[model samples]
Target: MSAGLLVAVLLASALLEGSGWAGGVGDGNLRLSVTVNGRADSDVRPPEVRVGTWVVKRYRLLNVSEADLHRVRVLDPGAPAGSVRCPAVLPAAEEAECTARFRAVAGRHVHPVRAEGDVPALRTRLTATARAGYAGVAGALGLTEEVVVATPGTGGGGASAIVTYTVTNRGNLPLYTVRVEDPGLALAPGAPDCGGRGGTVAVLAPDTSAFCRTTVRLRPGTYRSAGRASGSDRATTLGTGGERVTAPVLTAGASAVFVVREAPVAPVPRTPAPGAPAAGSSAGAAGASAGAGAAPAPGAPGALARTDTGTGTGTGTGTDAAGRPAAPAAPGAGAAPGAVPPGAVPPGAVPPSSVSPGAVPPAPPPGLRRAAGVDDEGFLGRVRRRGREAAEFGVATTLLLLLIPAAVAAALLGSRRK
Candidate 1:
């Protein structure tokens, strides 16, 4: 009977050890642990991540109970579907591994991973939390420049131009202490009003723009100008322990041409005097007035000179009917002839000098003189014209020499035939 009892005790101990119930009634338990970016959740400090970057999460599910687990699954609510993968079955005293991925967001984030499984006599569930801190430190800047030109009107003033600088934050972070500058252009007093901040922008948000404007007076000419913008990322400055980190200076350029022309002057009208002969009247009235011994009106036909038909006692004006001053009387002839002779001077002969000294000479005929600055040719134009003439002359000379050879050959052939 004692031997049988010892055999039974050994058999019971083997059964308990095989069933994993030796420590007591084996309980169904699942323990879940998570690691973020290779850092365990039990670490003193959370994992660090940059905003907009991918975070790798590793999950480990261990079945510590004596009962085998079935239909085992791991899940993270924040992660997308199919991002976490693991085996469906877990045996007693066995561990399973899973992986999940998610994008890090701004600020602190709490990620919870849970494991669930079904046992023969009990259901098991476990939860774990992984914390991460994300920082946004990347920044980008953009700049653009525009110019508007205004010309002077009839009212006299210099040409004016308005220049505008547009500063843009192109990154995912806020930019601080934004400044814009233009070295090639002089700004007006109290100029560069960037949102009334005078060329400075306190804060510029992502994907937004700010405008800076200044006015300048310019002469008539062409202008080329460029603008530069610079700013620092707020998060980057703080993350780097107060070490200032600035974005690359952005540059934009624009060119424009301006011309200010002088205004034209208007002419004043002239009023005729009272009781004067009307302009463009018939010549018969002028002759009748002269026959009546009345002096012709100024600016009337045949009003320049007059001669009397009475006896010649040198009482008549020494002028001909055609209004030309008479030539000197012939030798032995009277001082003033009775009637002035016609056809006195040959054709093309120059008349006697009638203009006094210090009198301004009459302007040359339009057909004989060219107006100043009208159809004028520059030095280059003259050079091109002379070159063309020389080319033509050379071509003519070559043609003449070729014709001479042909003519001589023809003449020689004719002589031989004769």
Candidate 2:
């Protein structure tokens, strides 16, 4: 029944059912629903059509039952006039979509068409609201559930939605096939359950207040849901509920949601004093030079003048300008670019021969040099284009060697048909 019919039935159910809950109890209190709408019956102009013209029809079906629907069917009336197939049925309360294709030939006319189908005793009706050239019509099943209910949930990291359903037998009648129909949750490839069906999961029982759980990628908002329960004898919607969802939770390792968030680092500001020397330098003061009376600079400035500036490598005992070990000198680091010959050392400075040897690096493989002036992108592109050209040539050759000649021979032997 469509929503309109459902409302009418509900208003008069008490009379027909012989008291509410006394008669008219269906499959679990859930019944499947179907709806269609779009450019079918509009009166802007007469339905216009062309030769070999094609028309696309869109349809959506919502299970609207707590139990997942299996093998639902939708029959379109415009069919025999040349129609395609019906999309599969959605699970209980869940919805499935299907499209039908039709051809309209120009200068041709069609009579008003209508469609109908039967789900056992439940009957569905479809009628043309628009023609080939006009807008379409809208339709749906009418089953008014007195009590409106909704439930929403959330998940993250590809976790299944944990939904719990309570099926209680408030009345004396025994509920036979108590089940749940779940709409799929949005999930990405990397999620834990990505490879499996997050669409519909079924759990059936006769227990009072049964629980149903589903893990969907967590979204933040409210979700609307309705359910139907019944015995094996019939199909009717019984009860419905709603739920809400929230954001993902982050934790540690693969087993749980945990990522250790380190505290942010802060910059250390320098002191803004007049003449205070910088910290972290060797602790010393600038005193007078050994000569007569060289005024000593203050603090650290005085310390540098007193330190050795040269190596000692003269004769058997090499000597530097400051008379320190030759190994201590690093004049090349301070030398102007190109000031010294390649491999030449400053006076008393240690040469490469004097340094301690470590491991020698292996030589380059035989053909490991960069291709001269050959940019990687340009080279790769050319190679790819050459391969494509070769492929084209091969195809051309094969066609000339096989297909074309065969086609020519076939043509020579033509007129045998017709």
Residue 312 miss distance in model 1 (angstroms): 40
lDDT of 1 by residue, 1-418 (tens): 9999999999998777556456322433577777766656423444545455576767788778666677777767655688888787787778988777767565445545567777645333333333332233345678887888775655455577788888888777778888877766655333688988878888989889999988877755566666667777745222112223334443334434444444333456667689766666658768867787975433233444333432333533356666566654432233232222334323443222434568865655564243322336678877887799999999999999999999999999999999
> TM-scores across all candidates?
0.39, 0.19
Best candidate according to lDDT: 1
What lDDT would each prediction earn against the true structure?
Answer: 0.62, 0.36
Instruction: For residue 141, give model 1's deviation from the true position in Å.
Output: 5.7
User: What TM-score, to 2 decimals, does candidate 2 have?
Assistant: 0.19
Deviating ranges (above 4 Å) for candidate 1: 1-28, 38-48, 67-72, 87-91, 118-161, 166-174, 177-211, 214-230, 234-418
Q: What is the C-alpha local distance difference test score of candidate 2?
A: 0.36
TM-score, structure 1 vs. true: 0.39
Residues 1-418 of candidate 2 have per-residue lDDT tens digits of 6999989988786554433233422333332222222333322332332223344444444443333343444444543433534444344444555555555332323333222222332332212122323221111111111221223322222222343333343322233333333222232322222113222223222223433333443433344434332322122211111111121111111111212122233556777478655564324323212342654322212322223345333332345766554444333333443334234543444443444569454433333323312335397877887799999999899878998788888987895763
